[model samples]
Target: MKVAMIGAGYVGLVSGACFSEFGHQVVCVDVDERKIRMLEQGEIPIFEPGLEKLVADNVAAGRLSFTRDLTGAVADAEAVFIAVGTPSRRGGGEADLSYVYQAARDIAGATEGEKVVVTKSTVPVGTGAEVRRILAETNPGATFHVVSNPEFLREGAAIEDFMRPNRVVCGVESKHAEQVMRELYRPLFLNETPMVFTSLESSEMIKYAANCFLATKITFINEVADLCERVGADVQAVARGIGLDRRIGNLFLHPGPGFGGSCFPKDIRALAATAESAGAPLRIVETVNDINESRKKAMAAKIIDAMGGDVAGKTIAVLGVTFKPNTDDMRESPSLDIVPALQQAGATVRATDPEGVREAKELLTDVVWCEDAYTAMEGADAVAILTEWNHFRALDKGRMKKLLKQPLMIDLRNIYPVDEMEKAGFRYVSVGRRAVGN
Candidate 1:
């Protein structure tokens, strides 16, 4: 299979690399000349685990390549995948599809023969129809089939997700497009990865619906954590109790500073907007968006209350800044809200993350950056565990007490056991659990 990927962003790059690793020839195209050059030089722009190695290995095997010339790549390809970004629009929460439309036009002009044009981007419903319209208008004589194939890769675990997806949802109306898609994913077929064949609208809705439901789950747990705090119950125990039930398996049930990532926030907002536009508004999803936004800011108050109802003139060490562990992406990260709120409340913020610091630096301002987590804790009034990085899971309690101005630990991710922290002679505050030594 010869595939042309018409974008070199996260989805495009990861998908192309994974496809090539599956023994297919893939050429990834991007309009960013600098990004293309970087990819060509074996320099990946994003920080995804196992991605660089995969790209390098496939490139070495002459199976994967990068280019800025979409025309050249599309001419020789059997399938052209538009895996571009669909960031939220400014005024409305609708997905900005200009890039996708432009890619369609470019693909339409470049496609030489019968080719399956696949929308691997997370787009709104009716987008495939619009792309089909664009193709017909751009090239009346071209023979192409537009198929919607949404991606469902987690940021930190994209490679694993791609290789062993739970399911592959594809939207197609023609036999030619379906056959091309089947051939493209034949490797997964051997693994019995379920193939969900549906209409373009259903496939598009599936992507948004999945992310929105995950966001709702996070928000629900967060609210339950708040209730646990009031009722003198441990939210972790509650999560465990409910998670044991087959109806409510534990996945996004861990309570924290709410959900934030490239997909969840944008996808949920877009879904709400789309639903409202259709005159069938999703109130729960809309509320989830509001609650998650407010929850990020509320976490600052959690830290502030732990610091004797004030953070003025205090230096707080933030152990992690990224939304979650194992990824450096800071897009809509809770730290973006929590850090600034703490700063506004007159706290001097010292932050450290194993992977997110470089990207966090651009979004966060007026904060002290540290080389390591322990270094960030030095002379801080309290330590807030924002992200559950592997290293932060186990810490030298004695050293942390010696480094901090006050032996206070706010475990947002609930990484530490309350009894252990109390045994360590530190006041511990955590979500969905009773405080110790407050």
Candidate 2:
């Protein structure tokens, strides 16, 4: 199968590479000539686990390629995937579908024969029909089918998720389009990954619904963490107790600063807008967005309170700036909100991350970037763990205690047990758990 993937961003690059790895010929198209040039030289523009090696291997085998020529790529492809970004529009919570529409117009002009145009980006309901209308208007005699195939890959684990997804949801209007999609995903079919065939609107709604539900789960746990703090309970044990139930599996149940990444925040807001436009507002989703924002501000206050009130003129060490561990992506990270708030309260922030510093430098200012966690803690009044990276899990507690000017440890991710931090002779504060030491 020949696949032309439009937009070469995170979704396009990962999906194109994975498709090539499955023995399909894939050309990843991007508007940025610089990015395409970088890929041609075996260089990846973004940081993703195992993506670099996979892309390099596929390119070496001549199964994958990159190009800036969108027309040339689409003209010879069996499936043209519109994987462009639909960023949230300013002042309105709706997803801006300008990129998706532009791609459809270009593909309609370039396509020669029957082609499957797949919407691989997370979009609102009826977006596929809009694409269909755009193509029909652009090319009066063109024969093409618009299919909805929303991506479900998470950052840091995108490659694994793409290669071994639990199921693949595809929306097609015709049996011919369905057969092509099934054959294209034959590798996953062999692996027994179920494929759900549904209407275009249902597939579009599925992506937003999944992301919003996950965001709600994280928010619910965060609120529970706050209650746990007031009632002197442990959120970790609470999460475990409920997670053990067969019906309620634990995945995004960990309490943290809040849910912040490329997907959840924007998708939830867009879904709310979609609901409102249709005369049915999503009240719970609207509340989830409000509560999540408050959670981030509240976390900053918790850190200040742990420092014996007033962080004025204090040097605070922050660990992990990325939304989560294992990826360098800093999009909508909770640290973006918390760090600025700390600075506003007159605290000089020092931060360190394994890979996020490069991107973090753009969003965060007036912070000293350190070589390691201990370096970040050196001479700081308090240390706060914002992201639970693997390196942070087994830190030398005694060494950290010795390095910090004040032995105040705020484990926002609950990386350490209260008894352990207390035994190490440090005052500990964590989310949804009893505070240890005075």
**What lDDT would each prediction earn against the true structure?**
0.93, 0.93
Model 1, 23-67: lDDT tens digits are 999999998999999999989899899999999999999999998
Candidate 1, position 369, lDDT: 98
Q: What does the lDDT read for residue 202 in candidate 2?
A: 95
Task: Give the clash total for candidate 1.
Answer: 1
Candidate 2: which pairs clash? none
Query: What would the per-residue lDDT of candidate 2 be over residues 1-438, giving only the tens digit for each residue?
Result: 999999899999999999999999999999999999999999999999999999999999999999989999999899999999999999988999999999999999998768899999999998999999999899978898889999999999999999999899999999988998998899997789999999999999999999999899899989888888788888988999998888888988999999888899999999999999999999999999999988888889989999988999999999999999989989889899999999999999999999999999999999999999999999999999999999899999889888999789999999898899999888899889888788
Which 10-residue window in model 1 sums to the lowest lDDT? Answer: 108-117
